[model samples]
Target: MTSQFPNTLTPKMVEGIKGFNLCTFLIGLEGWRRGLTLKYYSDINQYSDIHTQGKKLMGRNYSLQSKDKIHYFNQSRGDMVSNEAVRIAQSKQKTKDYLEKGNVNILPSKEFDKTHSDVDIIKLAREIGYPVIIKPTYGSLSKGVMLNLKNDSELTDALKYVRGQLGYSNVILERYFEGADIRVYVVNNVAVAALRREPPKVTGDGESSIEKLINEKNESRKDNPYLAARPIKIDKELKDVLRKNNYKLSSILENGKTIMVKNKSTLTQGVDLYDITDTVPEHVKQLAIDTLNALPNIIHGSIDMLFDGEEAVVLEVNASANISMHMFPTEGQPRSIASFLMDFYFPETKGKSSNHTNMYFDFVDIVNTLKQNYTNYVEVKSLPQPPLYAKKYIVTGEVQNVGYRNWIRRQATKRELHGYTKNLKNGNVVVVVASHEKEKVDKFKRVCKKGSKKSKVSDVKSSDWTKEIKMGFEIKDNITKKKKEVDKKYINELLTELKETQTKLENAKKMQEELRMERDSYKDKLSSIRNSTSWRVTEPVRVIGGLLKGKTKVKN
Candidate 1:
């Protein structure tokens, strides 16, 4: 995920803010930055509910709180949505029924069960028509979905795999939509973000194969926080699409040629999501809002639709839709979906805090402690406002590799400071410490003068540091001045030692083989001598002679 969008985080702020956590943290942090307290918890006891601080929370769910209000969320779903609405959204057939009852335009479609025969399915298909999509009745994220079935054969194969192989007993069939796949995020009857799910594609340079082009595209995409989470996989479906076009990943395309890499476009399909919040027509956004409004207890979410030039058709509505895509699109201006969510939830906090802020909590630690079962919930310290106290101390003298950095790290950690100590090339160590408390920063500066036992600090120069300070204390061995000649010499030494050892082992093995051959030859000669007729006759005579010599003792 190559990141084209601007990053406001500390250069190396906590990672693990990807996947589901990406959306979860974005939405949670958006509110928390507005002077709200945020807490993330696990549902260890799924059947248990919680009453903390006199408020009855459904469970140990993730929540954002203020003095007067607190909103609990199960993933992306907030307390505003009812369980009924959630249930309806979970089922495609039920969602269709709800939307139709609300007079929202739906594509001609029908749901079927396992009882429906192939003939019956074909009959209904003829009535509704060909070139349709067949998907599980309760599928999400494009799983068990077959798009654009042109005839009975295509539909049959799709059904066989999605139903028979995948074990989805119920399915819905709908007309093949001709348009871009668009999702409009609606909140409080207002359109917030609209994104077009573009299929994975590549433009040829007339130099590289399609595979190489895709690799290059991926190289750029891997830096993005959202797009890089799940890279575009070259799977069977993508191969099939290429084969259909008389091409393969290895086939080099003509310069300036662009082709869609896959047929289906969705998050599951590694679609290149583009934020088109501005370009999507006002009507399309309105339709999204209207469709969202039609559902009961559903105030906000993403409405999936397909839009041709003239018409837009609602496909489905996602209740707990992730806002990550909107926040970080592969291309186009990133939409501030978080602000919209915060505005809906805490209207009074609008503009109270700038959205262009860098106040982020330790998302990685909280998630980790939960997984370790350290506790059910880890309440992240609501990050304070910007312009935190920062200080820098460059300790000159016997600081490098003398446990000086580790000692400083311990001191900083004890004081709960945020920053790092790194070794410099000039036999000095740079220690940067930051915190919300000025006294803590000043005390750390004083402590830098007194390093580890072995360190002989000549002078400790202190100054105010203005750079972004990361969330935790660390000792960094950050020298990048590589000694290529020294590395080559070391490698040569190792190779020489290894080659000598290998030769010695090989010679030893050869000697062992020679000894084994000699032993085998002697044993073969002895067996031949024993098996001969003369040796058998001599054996009795030799035994008689031995008895004669021992006659006195044997009394024979």
Candidate 2:
């Protein structure tokens, strides 16, 4: 559509021709107020005057003669046209011109293509290449845009499926661009705000199962605007994607780990958006504007750009873009979109600039702070002298029943310190020692700090006694002397019994060796005797003759 301001005129004529007086053009008034200009107030009052007074600023010849008079020569509406054209130009790959200067305005009675088909879009993509985008021609936001189609088969399959489901054949197919998607809002030929959206994520707690967590998230989405409208449904698409990542709904998630469901950070999908305005360097802003200008028919529209590093590619533009912050507000406040519309209506009032000086931080406060707290600041100092006179301390906890007393005893013995430790009645350790070396005291303190593994130091009370102590360390007798006497007597008896048993065992071993030697000697002697007997003949008296003689004697 042609701008109310005529484009045929020279720069001088353009400047001389007045726009809608502040009162008549609502958008223009909005621009001035947002522009932070004092002239905006003057213009507002002037419009109010025209409503009340008969006088005119430029006399009656000017287009806006009175409050009711419409200024047909204004270019406020041209913003929408220029924005659309810039988008188209960028999508068509007009890089340099779009960057240098954004699209100015659309031609008179300009119209976008109302009907487009998947088949026609596919042809465009195939001409562009295998990878192209297929989206609805008349889509809201970025619905129905797909990427990375390698062949006609996939395209045909997708085309047939969407057409059957949505019952709309007018789908937009454009060349696919790979990179991070960006959203930038341009108001009245100037970029107002921009943001880079990140994909969705879920962090793991190491305890909850992914499916349980997803259910919880879905439940939460019932209250969250970003995820409320269309709850994230568990379907074949999500299942397939999850399966590809080796993720099962029942899988336990590790703590601090994040899982991403989709590639884009759209409210309809699962994704997170991190604001990048602070990090968006100067050059990037120019590139975005350039990308927008390439689209010839877009004015007052949002341009989505895909960027890898500094190299940006123009994505689809949204003509009737939703004031997105409704679904997701920016950092702090909900933006005043109505005011933005008012600015677009009043274009001429915004040209006047405000000269208010902004106050910033001063250095006097820094010096004052230093003076107040300078002594408290960190400073390097020499180490303090070590403790001069060493004192023995006995500290214990749940040490006795847990064999901690023995541990302490062994430690003291190893150190050759004069001290003895024993378990107390109330589960405390009582130790006494006389040591002068500072190093030993330090070492003992160190050991006390880390007590026995099973023991907890509930209290450690120490005192310096007035009574003179002996130098040599000894295991002092217990207050119950009878128990100590019994223990000592038992130990002596055990030692004596062990010695007697050991002597008897040695004697028995010696006798066994001696007997074995004697047996061996006898065997040799027997062998010699047997050899001598074999050599000699044997003539002996018969037992039968002796028996006959004995019988004869009996008979006599």
Candidate 3:
């Protein structure tokens, strides 16, 4: 089985696994947990090389020299999809052509270049009928897509926006189909999951204004992992959508009424996903599988369609990267598409099952790895080198007292590299790395330059030093005796200050208790005096004296 699939890894998978790219991380985590050795190169120094030779690294780019062959993945999509398949699927016009050729029911669409006049484009839409959709020829995540163009003015405006605003030279106009937006994820010509993507909407509560309702709806989505990053915006598009429904930002809607706020059903635009896998018709599943089979060398991807009653029309096919709708549907059982992908990559482990909780890599480990070596931008390419190499590095600038040593140690251990990271007296970090693979060593140096999240690394100087370092990596205690003495003095000073504070606190408590006792004694003495027989006898004499004084004053 190892000989059949072969071990593989991608740079994107390594760097992205540490960051917010959940799709890439899920696939990489699944592969790592399944016992496949993964290697990646994401240092800034290698960016130029990767950028220049990116095309050559496509489709089974490198083979891992493992004893057993294990299939590797790029992003979450495995080797099942080919470079050609991704290219064709990226273009809307090209995808429509292939679907039509496969006898699939796709909406009639016409491709137009920027040179086409508004008259020509509007004329084409008229022929296709009113309520046509205009979108960029090549795009994803529903960017630059306009729907429900019911007039020449609307079509003309959409063309300008797609061309002028979006800067897309090529655009496609298609007949608009009204139905529930559905997506079917297929793996190896088998439908594994289905989702119904509904446009972002807010239900009216009868009293609150439309804007207030939208705010409430967005607030509810703030805690969702997927929805938090992509909230509905009150932009021009949203305003237009509301206006079309005879509403505005200030409109107070009737109770139970719901209005769609966006034209396209994209998850990034707050679209809701409903898992319809079990309830989806067999014919619909077959159609999704057939759509993938229609494309050459495409075994895994999603088929987007519009379904009305029992009939479904193909909207588009995405092979470049699979959307994560199945993993976190808003209204249905969340599916583990990551596990499914791992099963496809490593077929030998299909029957072997583990606890569901153990299937994912540790989140803390992933975060630490990211903090050590991850950058916001990572390209999908490979580094040109053998499995093992060695290097020594001197990382300067804010590298001390920031947990940099522990971060580098964890990074080396995760990559199975032998290296030592220690703090120098000069406030620099020195690292000696030796790995069986050169890419691993390169990645280590890159991570050192980035340092931990708390450390600010100014520069990283590297040199070849395989001959000097021994096997296994450890953090060497290189602090001088003088520095240790200084540390001890600082600790003593803190201890003295703490003791003084404690004594002051105790003194304050004692004074408070004494004050309370003195006040209570005074109260007791006053009560005793008031209750005495002498006081009672003096009360009657005082009253007689007061009356005599009053009588003398009246006579005077």
Candidate 4:
């Protein structure tokens, strides 16, 4: 079944998958599940025939091939996204104009080029009204976005910071709209999900200072998969925001008080996401759908808006790349946007079970594939001979724990062979070698023939190793130390399991106690009702009624 698809696993694919970008990984996973041959092409390694001109390539791009048809993707956005749409989306001014033409409510904005003077910017700001936003026309991740510039002086300084420090040539001034920062993801003219994004903030615990509280919050962010690596930065902008709120890092906040740490709502900048797909108004959803339809050749995109109760104003349209906030939302139900995208890309695969857990590739295999490709790339660039030769050697001798594995690793590394040496359970050492040069593999095998000083090499069996192997040489230990480490790991696992069991037991006991208390309270209520004055007063009536019922039964 695997051989039915084209081999898309290459060196470039490895580099693309090794990053912290969840979107890229998710896309790769989706493609793999959908039966598409996914390949990563790294420009750095000169894989996929990318011209580097002796310069190091620094990034990896992706391609999904379905037989004869192939689709290229960068990040989450794919070939479906038009270059014109991307250009318009990159410019805030263009996005606003497009939204306005579509009858979507948009904050009034004025565009400025590098040639624009500060006076011209201030004039535009005055026209837009006070408390306007100043931001780069073509920027992302909330970088170079300055909110609520009240006066000309503030705008002047912000413009200088954005232009001089941030190096943005184009800028826009728009009326600041304060409300929920919501992002609606639309695919194929349909709104799939929506999320309300909140800027990074901390709640007061009464005891800890604001700075301490922020630090604690940042530490807690490490638990969130999306936020783990990206912590909220403590910078001048944050301090300015605090000062504006009449507080500082040293200020102690009262219990239950909440303070915003950043001015903009950007997930990369630690913004929190709340899935509001089910609750977002139909009109808002329609607005997002309309916004996407307004732009040509945009099969999928995200519409960032500010919902100010009365209306949802389109803030920007992101067509080039957008975060998958709906997938890993901080609150509310997660939406399967990846599945939706896959279905959109391959409509015939819709309704077929593509469970992510069941379709994942082996991590080690991916790493090895990448390594082999990289080795080939380097050999092509630097070595005179092509590097595609590989061999696996199994030696039966006194090789267990005699440092034979390390010796094999040194030998392979010296020849630039990418593979690993492991101690087999049968007291034999298995060494795998992968190289483009045949002599290198033969040389490595010859070196393995003479066992290390502490061991004896009885027989060396060699075979062609055509499978992908890891980069560099690695020594796999099956000695007492490795066993001890494994034992320790199991012990930790057992301890964790015990702790979880204990917690469940405690919760069960607490629940049992609450149930008993409720049962007792109900019993007491029954006893009180039986001993009530109403019961006493109606006792003779009850006796008379019983006698009458008996008489009626006898007559019948």
Top candidate by TM-score? 1
TM-score of 1: 0.78
Best of the two (1, 4) by TM-score: 1
**What is the TM-score ranking, best to worst?**
1, 4, 3, 2
How well is each residue in 248-341 modelled by candidate 3, as lDDT tens digits?
A: 9999989999888888886568777778899999999999999998899888888888899678999888774444456656677766676676
Please tell me which predicted candidate would have the highest lDDT against the true structure.
1
| TM-score, model 3 to reference | 0.60
* Candidate 3 segments exceeding 4 Å error: 1-20, 43-67, 351-556
| Residue-level lDDT for 146 in candidate 3 | 84
Each candidate's number of clashing pairs is 9, 39, 7, 7
lDDT of 2 by residue, 1-556 (tens): 0011111111221122222221122232233223322111212223332221122222111122123323321222232354334333323223223433544221111111336555565566566676655655444435455555568987786676556565545555555566676766666566666666655456789999877777766675443333344444566546755797999878888998988655444545643433455465556666556555555545455556776776665554544344433223323232333244444645443432221001111112222333454432211111112122234556755666675666666676666554456556666676654344556755676565467778777656655532222222344424676886898899999999999998988988889889989998999888776577553433134456688899999999
lDDT of 1: 0.79
lDDT sort, best first: 1, 4, 3, 2
Give TM per candidate.
Answer: 0.78, 0.40, 0.60, 0.62
Error of 4 at 194 (Å): 1.3
Q: Which stretches of candidate 4 lie over 4 Å from their true place?
A: 1-20, 43-60, 351-556
Which is the better candidate, 2 or 3, if ranked by TM-score?
A: 3
Against the hidden true structure, what lDDT does model 3 obtain? 0.70
